[model samples]
Target: MKVTSAIIAAMCLVSLNLGYGAFYVLWSIADQAAVARSEAGGGFDPSQLLPYGNVMWVLAQLLLLAILVLDVVAIVLAIATWAGRRNVGRAAPSMPTAAPGR
Candidate 1:
C-alpha cells in the first residue's frame, strides 16, 4: 500500500539523517582533538593521527548499524503489506456477489 511505502521511505530518510549527524559530530570532535594534540606536542606526530582513524572506525560502524536498521524496517514493511493483501484476498471470497445480470 501507498501508506506503507511512504512510511518505509520516511524511515530510510530518518536513518540517513541520523547517520549524517553522527558523522558530522564525530568528525568535528576528532578534528578538534587532533588539532589540540598537535598543538600541545609543538609538531604533528604520526601517533596523533590515531584519533582521526578511531573516529572513522566509529563512523563506519554506526553507518553499518543504520543500514542494518533500515533494511530490517523495509523487510518488515514488505511482509506486513504482503500479509495485509493476503488477508484481504481471503476475505474477498466470502463476500456476497451481485447477480451477473439484473
Candidate 2:
C-alpha cells in the first residue's frame, strides 16, 4: 500500500510537470505566432510560423498524451489499492473460536 501510494504521488507530480510543459510549449507557439504577425505588419500568416510552430504543437500534443497516460495509471493504482484493502478486510474475520473441552 505504501509503495502504491508513493507511486501514485510520483505519477501525479510527473503529470503536473508535463501539464506545465505543455502550457509552456503552447505559450511559446503563441509568442512565435505573435512575433510573426508583428513582422508581417499585423497580418498573421500561417506560413510565416511554419516549422517552429509545428514542432511545438507536436511536442505539446505528446506532453498531453503523456499526462493522460499518467492520469490513467494513477487512477488504476488507486482503484487497485482500494480493491486490495477491501479484499484484505473480507479475508480476515474476528469470529470467536470454541474453547477446548467446552
Candidate 3:
C-alpha cells in the first residue's frame, strides 16, 4: 500500500533523527567535558588561537536540541498522519485525501 510505504519511510526517518539526536547530545556534553578537563590539566587555550572548536561545540549543542525537537515533531506528524487526522496536510492529504486537483 502506498500509505504503508510512506508510513514506513516516515518511521525510518524518525529513527534516524532520534538516533542522531541522542548521539549529538551525548557527544556535545562529553566533548565539552573533555575540553574542560584537558584545559584544566594544562592544555593551552588553543581555542583562542583557533576558534573553530568553540564554534563547532556551540553549533553542535544547538543542533542537538534542534534535532531532538524535530524528532518529536516527526513522531507527532507520523502518528497524526496514520490516524487519518484532518488538516495534517491539506495541500497533499494522505490516503484519506483520494488525490489532488479533485
Candidate 4:
C-alpha cells in the first residue's frame, strides 16, 4: 500500500522546513559572532577573534544556501512525484522507450 498524498506532502514539508531551519541557524552563527567581537569598541578586528576567517564563514554560508535550495527543490519534486504516482499507478504509462515498435 502507498502513503496518502497528504502524508507525503506533509513529510516533504517537514523535511524541507527542518532543512531550512538548520541552514538558517548555521548561517546566522558567523554574523552573530562577528557582531559580538566587534562590540569591543572596534579596537580589534572580528576576523582576528574568529576561529574561522570571514572567507571560510562566507563559504559555509553559501554552501548552506545551496543545500537549502536543493532540499527545497527536492521537497517539491518528491511531493509532485508522490502525487503523480498515487493518481496513476504503473498503468499511468511510462516515457516512450526505445524500441522497434516506436
Q: How accurate is candidate 3 locally (lDDT)?
A: 0.71
Cα lDDT tens digits, model 3, 29-96, are 76677667658755666553334667876887787688778778877877777676576556664475
TM-score of candidate 2 against the unseen true structure:
0.56
Top model by TM-score, which number? Answer: 2
Badly placed stretches (over 4 Å) of model 4 are 1-42, 45-48, 89-102
lDDT string, candidate 4, 1-102, tens digits:
245875776687678668767766765785677767677674766553555556766876686677678767867887798788788745755797797876
Local distance difference test, per candidate?
Answer: 0.74, 0.75, 0.71, 0.69
- Order the candidate numbers by lDDT, best to worst: 2, 1, 3, 4
RMSD (Å) of each candidate, 1 decimal: 8.5, 6.2, 10.1, 7.5
Candidate 1 residues lying further than 4 Å off, grouped into runs, are 44-102
Backbone clashes for every candidate come to 0, 0, 0, 0
Model 1 TM: 0.44
Model 1 poorest 10 in a row by lDDT: 46-55
Which candidate, 2 or 4, would have the higher lDDT against the true structure?
2
Off by over 4 Å in 3: 1-4, 11-15, 18-51, 85-102
